[model samples]
Target: MKSLGVIVEYNPFHNGHKFHLEQSKITTGADVVIAVMSGQFLQRGEPALVSKWTRTKMALLNGIDIVVELPYAFATQKAEIFASGSISILSSLHCDTVCFGSEQGNIHDFERTLAIMDSKKEEYDLRVQSYSQEGYSFPKASSMAFTEITKNDRVLDLTQPNNILGYHYVKSIGEQNSPMKAFTIERTSAGYHDPDFNTTTIASATSIRRALFNHGGQIENVQQYVPEGTYQSLAHYQRQAGGFHRWEDYFPFLKYRILCSTPSELAEIYEVEEGLEHRLQQTMKESHSFDEFMTRLKTKRYTWTRLQRMCTHLLTNTKKEMMQRITSTKKSEYIRLLGMSKKGQSYLKQVKKDTDIPLLSKVTAMESNMLNMDIRATCTYAMKFPEPARSEWMGLEYSKPPIRYNEETNTFI
Candidate 1:
């Protein structure tokens, strides 16, 4: 069976996500879909409003075959590392094609950008450095350098979220010389960070989350977009408790972690470099909240989001050695199955024997050290919630419910 791969954070699956999945299948003509998704944390350096397991179930309920965890270290990282780890997993799974959403759906443009980046690395690097020296954030510096080099306003626009990630996806695949075909689906109307959702078209996940947090999960605005199972799960959580989860509640713990760790220790964490540890150390003493510390330390070279992610990596005890080791590996050694359909089950059976990586369907498969750390971190994170919710986190498994598929309809239920 042909398999298509997707790299995602399904934070909470929405209508746009559903459309992407459908388009991926139609575009790739694949029988199975595999996703390398974020865990409890996402690339944005914030805890997921809901657990990864919950999101995985939503994926299966929406339209996906298999789901695998990207792990905390890679999930909460910069674009390059995030792309590398996720692409590595897809390559290992022997995916025939990988599809992702892109603001610029033109593959030729992305390839051209990659070619320029490859040939002009030195010039581009120097230009970025010069721009940084003149007081520009890394994103802005790189954007400026790229625009100057390419002389294409369109290429410069690739600095946006979807385009940047899409570029990294293509770049990583090229750098690794992987056989997988890369494709991009044109994004719909919703801007990723847009927070207003009462629209005729689909709403962004950000808007949906905002509505869920403000009014409750039962909002009619989002009900049509999300799967019934997803709504049920979220609404269930809300009715039993006072409200849905929020990353802000965990901010104190994250701050505490930074405050307790010394500069010497912070220096060892992944992405902590060039005396960033010192800045963090000094800022932690005076800053009370995560946002405040990040704002205080944000400078020309470092963006606020970048600094926050670095702090998150430190809080999670992600080390450079781990980063190096994971990258050096040919591919991910294990697949932490999140959710799948009956057709997916048959596909898994066919591929399981030949799969280069181990297929994991249970929590025990998380290896001793990894399991311990993940469980402890999840527990600590859940502590910010009330009594029953805290207990719920403890029992939440890495795997999700298997979705049933109707062969005749060729659709997931």
Candidate 2:
């Protein structure tokens, strides 16, 4: 079977995501589409609006044939590391192609930028360091440095989130020297950062999320922007109770972690670097709410997203030593199956025969150091949900069955 791999968070699967999936299949002429998705926390360094299981079910119901969980180690990282981990997984799965959404969908431009960055690594690093010393966020500095190097405006596109991710995807493909071909679908809706709900079917994940988070979790607000199935599923999930999470829900726990830990201790957490621990310690002392802390923590040199991710690692007790070990291993990690359609399961069987890395459909079948943090993160996330839901899944990762598409029943079970 011809397979195309797409990396997604699908925070809540919406119509725009549906369009991307459909267009990816059409563009690649693939019989199956596999997805590597963030587990519980997203790359943006925040908890997902819904649980990973809910998101995985939505993915399978819509168009994705199979969904694999991107480990928490990779999920909550910067673009390059995130892309590297994701692309590595797809490569290991032997996907022939990968597709991603981008604001500017010029393949030549992506290649040129990637080539320049790859060839002039030291120069680029030095330039980035110079601007970073001047207190600009690494993303901002990196974009500025690319502009200076290329003397072109298309490099400006890298500042947009999707295009940046697309760039990293290309870079990772190059780094791997993998056979997977990469393609990009132009994003036509509200931009990634756009938070206001537009009337069109094409709305940003940010817009959908903001509407849900701020407007009392009313599915009606985003119904037009999501597919009928997604809209209905969300309504069903909401009615059933225990869905939708806000950052504040976990702030008390985060606050306690920050208060109890020393700068040295916070420094031991992965991603807390270069005296950022000092600033974190000082900020936690005065901050009132999660929002207040985020605002105070945000600076030109350290984006709020980066700081938030660091704090997430702290709250989860993800250690620098553990991350260092994972990083140094220099191999694609296991493919943890989140869910699969019937056809997906069949395709996975073929993949299993050709692969040596663990294809983890059964969490209880094995234990690895890599899984410990993810399990901890999930348990922490579960604690924030309401009663029955929380109690039922407090440690269900080890017991819960992988979601399988019931072909006879015409539904996921």
Candidate 3:
């Protein structure tokens, strides 16, 4: 069976995701779809609206064949590292093609952009550094550098979120020399960061999440934007977890983490740089909430996303050394199986022996540093819950098996 890959968070699988999943299969002509999903923390350095297990079930119910966890070390990083980790899993799984939704839907445009960037690599790097030194955030500086290198209307608009991710997906595929081909489909309806519900069905996850939170965790608010399964899952997760996750939910813990640590200690956490430790310590004292802290902490050198990621690392106690050891290898140490449909199980059984990396179905006895980091992230994420739920959720890291979806019954086994 031909397998296609997608990188996803499924923050709560919604209508837009359903559309992308359906289109990806049709566009790639693949029999099975594999998703590399983020764990407790997402690429943007925010806790997922629901746990990975909840999101995995959502993916399996919504038509994803297999769902694999993107290790925390990579899942919460910037676009390039995130893409590299995602593509690595798909490559190990032997996916024939990977499809992503992007503003620049045409595949050739990404190829052209990659070519231009490659040809002017050194110049682009210098320009990016120069712009960064001039006080621009890395993303903004990179965009400025791209503009300096090419006025070609044919290449990707790097400023767009989905397009930036897509570019890195394609870049990683080439860098890793994977045989998997890349494909893109134009994003429909809402924009990546659209904060309000502007459409009836196809809305960005951001909008759906905003609505959910705005409405006090009411599933009905986002029912129209997500599939029935997703809506049900959201409702179920809220009932089970007591509330949906948001930055506000974890602010107290994060604030405590910030307040207790010395500046030198904070400096060791991943992404804390250039005296950010001192700023985080000082600003956190004056601020009581995540929003207030971020408002005070925002600077020309740091994007909101970048700062959030740094905070996530701080909260999880993820040190730069831990991240550097994992990233320096530039490969995923394991393919963590989160869930799989019957078709997906069949595909995995057929490919497991031939896969280049270990396929981890259980976390117990795992010795890899990367896997240890993932466990720590899970534990930290679980800390947000109250008493029994906290222990129960934390235990899931060691005990929860890969969720098996029985397609014939349309329920998880």
Candidate 4:
């Protein structure tokens, strides 16, 4: 059976997500849709509003055939590494094609941009470096360089988050020279960073998350944009001791990590550049809230997402040496099945024999340095999940079974 793979964070599964799943199936005519989802931390460098278990269940209920984790290392990185890890997993699954949401739906145009980047590799690199030297953010500098080299307005789309990811998806596939085809579904919803819940149909995950965590918007207000199952799952989490999580929920711990950390120790953390350590140290003393810390650190040169990711590495006690070892040693070599449908299970059964890397449906069954980070991240996230539910979520990686679809009941069991 032909399978289509999708890369997702599903920060909280909403209508936009369900729409993407359905459209990917229709667009690819594949028998099943396999989703590579993030666990506790998202690419935006924040904790997921809901637990991965809850999000996995949400995906299964909404039509994602199977959900495997994207592992914390890749899940929290910049887009290139993030896309590279995801594409490697999908390729391992022998997916025929990978579909992702894009700002510009046309695949050919995206490929053209990729071609320019490839052909002008050195020049592009140099220009990016030059612009970075001029105080522009890396992403902005890269975009400016690419636009100058390609001389194509559409090349500018790479600056947009979704389109940039789609571009990297195609680029990573090409770098691996894998057989998987790439496709995109144009995003026709709210802007990715829009923090409003006014949209009734397809709202951004940012907006939905803000509505759930910060804004007074309750489940009822969010219901108009998410599926019924998503609403129930979120409400259930809310009723639990922790409620829906936000980055601020764990701010005290992060602040403690910051204040207690030595400059040498901060420098040892992954992605802590020359001045960033000192800057973060100063901010820890000056800032009162998580938002304020982020605001103080966020410059044109360093995006909030980048700083948050650096903080995550610090909070998890992920060291520079350890990260180098983990990344160099593992190229997203394992796939942890989060949940799956009957069709998904069948596909896995058929393809498991042919897969090159490890497929882990059970965490305790294997020992991997790469997966160790995921477990650590889960433990850290569990600490913020209210009370008793925290321990359950803490051990959830090992205790819970991957969601199995009951075909007759048309529900997850």
lDDT of each: 0.75, 0.84, 0.91, 0.85
Candidate 3 pairs with clashing backbones? none
lDDT of 2 by residue, 131-241 (tens): 989988888898888778777434526768998899989988888888999999988767788878665678888889889877788888898898777787788777765
Best by TM-score: 3
Model 3: per-residue Cα lDDT over 1-413, one tens digit each? 99999999998898889999899999989999999999999989899999999999899988999999999989999999999999999999999999999998899999988998898899999999999999999999999999988875467889899999999999999999999999999998999899998888889999989888888887888888888888888889888888888898889989999889888999999999999989998899899789999999999889999999999998889999989988986679999999999999999999999999999999874689899889988898988898988998899999989999998899878
TM agreement with the true structure for every prediction: 0.87, 0.95, 0.99, 0.96
Top candidate (lDDT): 3
User: For candidate 4, lDDT tens digit of each residue in 53-106?
Assistant: 888888888887889999998999889889989999999999999999888988
Judge candidate 3 against the unseen true structure and give its global Cα lDDT, from 0 to 1.
0.91
| lDDT score for candidate 4 against the true structure | 0.85
Alpha-carbon RMSD to native, per candidate: 3.3, 1.8, 0.9, 1.7
Q: Report the number of backbone clashes for model 3.
A: 0
- Minimum summed lDDT over a 10-residue window in model 3 is located at 148-157
Off by over 4 Å in 4: 152-156, 386-388
lDDT of 4 at 53: 87
Prediction 1 TM-score vs. true: 0.87
Q: Per model, how many backbone clashes are there?
A: 0, 0, 0, 1
Model 1 ranges off by over 4 Å:
152-156, 216-221, 240-242, 274-294, 328-330, 366-377, 386-392, 395-413
